[model samples]
Target: MFATTDNGLSGTGKPESVFISWLLWQPRGADLAVEALKEVQKLSRYDDSDPDITRLRSLFVSLAGADGPLH
Candidate 1:
């Protein structure tokens, strides 16, 4: 479960990845968000061709309303 608490307000049980993606992508233009995602991809310890990473790339593409790789 995910949780956030501030000033006695709290939220929990949200998908952390979605929250992370929103924090990364919502405040910026699509190009910049995509660039940030590429940096995340580089920092990941998964295999270069991991399927989960592929899915994450697909999600970021969808978020940007575009098609192609994050790299």
Candidate 2:
């Protein structure tokens, strides 16, 4: 059996595990990042009344075109 929380996959006794999983699963492109961010923004609780939400939306859209640099 497993216990779950608001963030999902809870009760593992390893908080950082979720972050590691996310980092490993993340896509490797600016366009994908932009699209993901946009989806997140849409699902987030922040509405138009929130300044931060608007700023983040603008930033994601602005970066939607760049392919990002090779590391």
Candidate 3:
């Protein structure tokens, strides 16, 4: 299961301390793609008035494309 830290960053609960451990631990390509797509979709729904959201949406789009099917 995914767990967050007290500071809101992603955490492994011990040893490693990072906010993106889940991505590293995902077992399947399909699962990673689906999770990435969900994040992209959420970012796309952000308010137009938020500049940070625009940057985030662009970043997510880049990452989604990078994670797309290789064959």
Candidate 4:
């Protein structure tokens, strides 16, 4: 059995775990990053009222298109 929470994945433990998963799963190339950004954008379109998600969507947009060292 698993506990449920407001966030997806439920009682998986620390909030940091969700962020860590994102860090580890981040897209490697520009192409994949663009796709990832699109997906997040789609999610935002569904529910723009969530401040946290809106902020994340903004970050994705800001990072999506860029040239030269992304490092």
Candidate 5:
């Protein structure tokens, strides 16, 4: 699992492993993952109007589960 605060992010071992399993492999570190997630959030309008955004959001939702994103 992972968490976020005003300072930044922190995660247990498993959280990074999820990113490692992906072919694209993004979660290099807490700082980078947080930056990347921020970028993804910014790009996604969250209105379900864009398939790409919807898919990305869905991926994160699935990865994060009920706990939601790192925050």
Candidate 6:
């Protein structure tokens, strides 16, 4: 949902690759969130001190909407 736009995309090389990847994953966002959460849960067993984890959680919550996923 983020890495590209209808107007046009910028950057090159790595950024280009990442943008394409984001576009590909946009349709699987919810599944991505669930998998990310599952990964965090697994990592929590060892260490969950990464701030990136928090950011990932927040991004999913925002995407899920203020009320979150239905049911």
CA RMSD per model (angstroms): 8.4, 9.5, 8.2, 7.0, 14.2, 10.3
TM-score of every candidate: 0.34, 0.35, 0.44, 0.45, 0.33, 0.32
Ranking by TM-score: 4, 3, 2, 1, 5, 6
Clashes of each: 0, 0, 0, 0, 0, 0
Model 3 Cα RMSD, 1 decimal = 8.2
Q: Model 2, range 1-71, lDDT digits (tens) per residue?
A: 96665433223334345334544676775355556455445635555554444444444444445354211
lDDT winner:
4
Q: Tell me the lDDT of model 1 at 7.
A: 30
- Model 4 off-target regions past 4 Å? 1-20, 27-32, 66-71
State which candidate, 1 or 6, has the greater TM-score. Answer: 1
Give the whole-model CA lDDT for all candidates, comma-separated.
0.50, 0.46, 0.51, 0.53, 0.46, 0.43
| Per-residue lDDT of candidate 6, residues 1-71 (tens digit) | 55734323222224334334644766643575555445445434543354443444444444334354322
State the TM-score for model 1: 0.34
Off by over 4 Å in 5: 1-44, 67-71
Model 5, residue 27: C-alpha shift (Å): 5.9
Candidate 5 steric clashes: 0
lDDT of 6: 0.43
Error of 5 at 37 (Å): 7.5
Ordered by lDDT, highest first, the candidates read 4, 3, 1, 5, 2, 6
- The positional error of residue 28 in candidate 5, measured at the CA in angstroms, is 5.0
Superposed Cα deviation of residue 56, candidate 6 (Å): 1.0
Per-residue lDDT over 1-71 for candidate 4, one digit per residue giving the tens place of the 0 to 100 score: 96656654233444345434655686665475666466565645656665555555555555566343222
| Residue 48 in model 3: lDDT | 50
What lDDT score is found at residue 30 in candidate 4? 40
Off by over 4 Å in 3: 1-31, 66-71
